[model samples]
Target: MTNKHSETSFFITAEEAADQLGVSRATLYAYVSRGLLRAHPTDSDSRRNCYARDDVVDLAGKRRRGRKPVDIAKSTLDWGMPVLESAITLIRDGQLYYRTNNAVALSERASLEDVACLLWDLPQADELEITPSVLPDGWHLLKAHYAKVPIIEALLPLFAIASEDGQTGIWQCDEARLASGAATLLGALFACITGCCPDRHPLHVQLATAWGQGPVGADLVRQALVLCADHELNASSFTARCVASTEASLRMAIIGGLAALSGGRHGGMTERIETAWQAIDPDNMTAHIRRQLAAGVEFPGFGHPLYPQGDARAKALLGSILPDFRFADEIVETMRALTGKAPSIDFALVAMRRYLGLPEGAAFCVFALGRSVGWIAHALEQRRQGQLIRPRAVYVGPDPGSSA
Candidate 1:
């Protein structure tokens, strides 16, 4: 039997589930009996059952792996297993935590600086002495030349100059110096993004000032920054760790993280959501959605695999801002009805930008600024570990012996 549910659904019928697992009906039932998979009775027919597709896929993947070390290592790369340990963040039960504190709740009251201190294991933000580094010579010329470039791209050269001037040689600093450098880098980044000479004012307030926002807008920006601060072992964080594993400078690790985050599938997803919003007709949202669905286009900002229920960050941020933007509210409702998925944080960031009337790339700037904290945390942790992060590759190409 075919899966009658929408393709985006998390459940599948018994036949489809068994096919996915390459198992017989009897084995499928055995799996459910042993608690390897969960089954629910169908609404239309009580006799029929639907299985959790995620569980089935997980089991199938595990069964496909050989007992070789290379096979096991290869499997860990794609959400398969834990490849490394971390003490900074944990994602469990659809909730995100930073060092055992709930990240969502932290967002409610903490500034980005507070979260940075928490992640960096500092007693307080003041301990870091976070003063903005002076702008590199000719910064005005560089800024004017890159006025139209994407914010993420513009950050690379800016970071390179700041790193060269401010940082010592690779991995030579004590923890105190490293932490101080991290704070300085964060301040310099905020200065570059907001076009403001940073001061003792909170980074979020500086952002609000740069964007001409009042008190309420500043609070919203603060909340968004806290929520986006760190996620455990995400692509960019992992890349940061890999760079740090080589005993590179903290600036070098952050540069690697920025490069990874700029990919379309990572923090760059906000740009995709913005592009989709611009391409679709606002007056005919439903028809545009249906047409895009027919063309096999995946919705950019809905659903995160880690949060099977819904993205809590999105729920928290969007809950406050959705009522203000009717078009965004309608799009959220329509996409959920059509796809059985809720908005992810990327969507929430873009929606917040529109509500605040910020510039075109503000969403990404917020993400980069906030997530810089997490990247620094990872780099510091990896440096302490003092192990190179190289993993062996399982070669599947031509055999050198055969000269194929």
Candidate 2:
């Protein structure tokens, strides 16, 4: 009998093999038959086979190298290539690093403020001078009138007002002044999200106090914030860089990032995951998952292309909370068993919100708050490069002079 293999084993199951190869099961089997991949029988089920992960990765790398330049360029937008360079964050070999520090390791002991300082290349959080900004005129009135609005939506106008009311000379500022502005803007963002004035306490503590959470909940919030601080030029971060390249104020760059992140496929994914979780029948999770799959419902937070093995941030956060949240653990196991995918950070954030009994949109709020740190980092980096982020189109449309 063959030995059973876990997810971390050198051998991966058939579904993972196919996914890594970007091929169908039949194609994967064909590869095995043609001796391009090696398959081993599983001990739990003799009929099922697993492929050697090294073989799949090697074949995938060769296939990638053989692709056309245009194909590679198109794939770049979908996790294909490194479009630009940054020293802020690196996702490699299934681990996430912020600069030279491991993000997961930092999350264990550092606060979001600490990660911000690290990503911003500052010596200490004190350099940020993270004092809350005075609210814009009519800010309270706007909040009271739009009290039922989603926090992300409500924040847009608030940021606009703040941007307009404050100094618009960020593009000409030195690093010290820029850092001060970033710190103030971050404090203001926290105030907007939590609907309370921030004091001298750390941002996570302020958030926890606003939400009525205790010390344990505050620590969880800290971990989530630190983990979500940056992810190497995600959509929102890219948007931020583009705006900053135009010499826009840091607040404006952050505004662009917020707009990008509000999309359902980006930071808004937390809400989708929350909704999906609500639809799931915890008692009959596997059956419900199968039914959802049969109906062509895409599970929102199960997979990430960057980490073909698993999202380490998700794993770290989930590892911390899953032992206490039995249903969440079941969902993670059932989803992996059914789809050969693992929970993403989105899933972990939603699970954390549920476990903490926070309000409905708390997950997204946490994401936006934490990710603002990254936006600031990218903005500062782009400003230093001092180049406009303009890309040429491939001109797929019909020629303008052609009458056809």
Candidate 3:
């Protein structure tokens, strides 16, 4: 509660309102500048400003909740529990569970041709309804590393940049620049989110059961890559807007945005990258799981809905070079059996890491790196919004504790 400047009939001085609102003068001004409230210049000198009393009161009644940071690299289930066996059975009976003949006879053929054939098996695009993803002719990484474009351009048929020039007009980043930038950011995010790509992906937790914890490091790296990029609208975006509202420098706003993304909930899932592997330690599945639970942590990376059959990402990546991936036919079958739902990217990557003998921490690193792309895009968009990140809300509150 700071001091007040003065009170007027329809409004209050910036200083007085600041005091009455129980916030710093700077805080009050921030809301005003963000267009959350109306401001009026007081006198000829322009030394003072006044704001509508009602607006001030209304704003005070609305407080925004802090955003949780997003860890895109962290794995989430597509649906409910897919695998529910202990590590012991995963290792022992895994041979029976993982073996699959469905794609077996076909996978042995030439990879490129075989994969092309597999493409035909792909479920109908309209079924997904969200959007049909496509691989832009160039780059090849097993884990669904098709071409990624910025939302602004991706949404447009011509891949044109969104601008304010007019219906048929506008000026923004050109196609070349946007495409190049979008691809680079997305690639980085993928690497960060999952420890590897299709050719380079690791076996995720659900898939990692057959393999030990030794070689999954590369998969963790991919996790970092995936966590690095995503939609531009996230918690960090809000923070970036807060800074940009002040007309602050781009660098400063981005810094603020990054800070917001670092919080848990948003970025928390990234930890699952590492958690998934810990469950697959070769020493003992039951013991490891028990220890993990006692420590208040659960296994990471399993289950998904989009690919109720299995993580298309995993199936595709493994299908690309299953024989070369070095996992036993039985173990693969075991994973398939356990996963009642889709085998998400995380589960596939974790399994690969276990098969390859990579070190620990690779998963988390991958996740962090992957989401960095989305963060950068958001930071850039925040500045472009040309408005502060302020949302209005209903002001329903009970009378002060006992003061009512």
Candidate 4:
């Protein structure tokens, strides 16, 4: 196609456009064939083509789904468009922030309750206290029923009980009441997991006491809870928000979040890393790492797509624990030298739990406990917006009349 261009307009040659998209010229031509791009004939020669620099730059951010070019209408779902707007959290520059505050920095000193208030935008000056209470009667039978099951597995029955008992009314509360209820829910979950009554102490101290640790463990638990509090539109958070959008109770919404978090890809990520760490002999760290590398097996905790340089959360948590623990330092240093990649938050959590001699699924439990706060905050936010989060689907199914 012949097109007129102004002298001030920006344009790039075919080679430059291909380089910009990180694709071969043949692939660029295929894009042209698919009408995703148009080649403009220059005044000097029709054979020489020029493309709009703006168009090339825009297309650079797009990726072909699977082995095929995505359908034009559906392509926007792949990071091309904003599905929803939220004022809660942001993931920018490979760092996480809650509202306007830096989450990592806050994790150093803020309790999980403080972070929850920040997330919910509750008045900072108000008394933010969650009174711990004894479980209701016959709860022991309920606890006994799930005692032999995994901690996360037991969460489902408790969720049902809370919903049935109308405890899910927290979502329908005012901002202040909602914050208080959130704290109570978090404390209750912890109590159920450890079989200890919720203490009036700060969440970290309570967790440390329940886990049979001292001051150092309390500090680490605090940091872990703060770090794990919230991430923008993550799988579980999205699930929570979606349920809330349906006018479900806060407990139901959090239950949805917990269901999603239990998947192997989410909080269960730590379990995989812990299993791998358990298999390796730390005495022969180098040899074991090399063998795993040679076998073409990927170490779970070392790499993360969101943080190409490294996960700041991992860096902070590892730095905090490594000085006090020797094996953790060795595992971290060896993994870094071997993979040239830093440990992810998953890896750091498993390392901390192992070093502290916590239970088998402690890492996952810690994550779920902390993330419940975020889920509550998100559900409350979604409730205020009063909008359903339904997205349209493009069907590629066969026609019903097609008998051939």
TM-score of each: 0.82, 0.81, 0.35, 0.78
**Candidate that beats the other on TM-score, 1 or 3, i.e. the better one:** 1
Write the residue-wise lDDT of candidate 3 on 146-239 in tens digits.
2253211111121111111122111113422332333333333333233233222222331233223332433333332332223223455446
Give the lowest summed-lDDT range of ten residues in model 1. 163-172
Off by over 4 Å in 4: 1-82, 123-125, 162-164, 170-176
Weakest ten-residue segment in model 4 by summed lDDT = 64-73
- lDDT for residue 86 in candidate 3, whole number 0-100: 14
lDDT of 2 at 59: 86
Q: Which scores better on lDDT, 2 or 3?
A: 2
Please write out the lDDT profile of model 4 over residues 279-327, one tens digit for every residue: 8887797788789898998677787655678888888888888888887
Ranking by TM-score: 1, 2, 4, 3
Better-scoring candidate (TM-score), 3 or 4: 4
- How much is 21 displaced in model 4, in angstroms? 21
lDDT of 2 by residue, 308-398 (tens): 8899999999988999999999998888888999999999999999999998788988998899999999998898889999865556888
Error of 2 at 41 (Å): 31
Query: Candidate 2, residue 403: CA error in Å?
Result: 1.9
After best superposition, candidate 1 residue 385: deviation in angstroms? Answer: 1.1
Residue 65 accuracy (lDDT) in model 4: 40
Query: Which candidate leads the pack in TM-score?
Result: 1
lDDT of each: 0.82, 0.82, 0.38, 0.77
- Pull out the clashing pairs in model 2: none
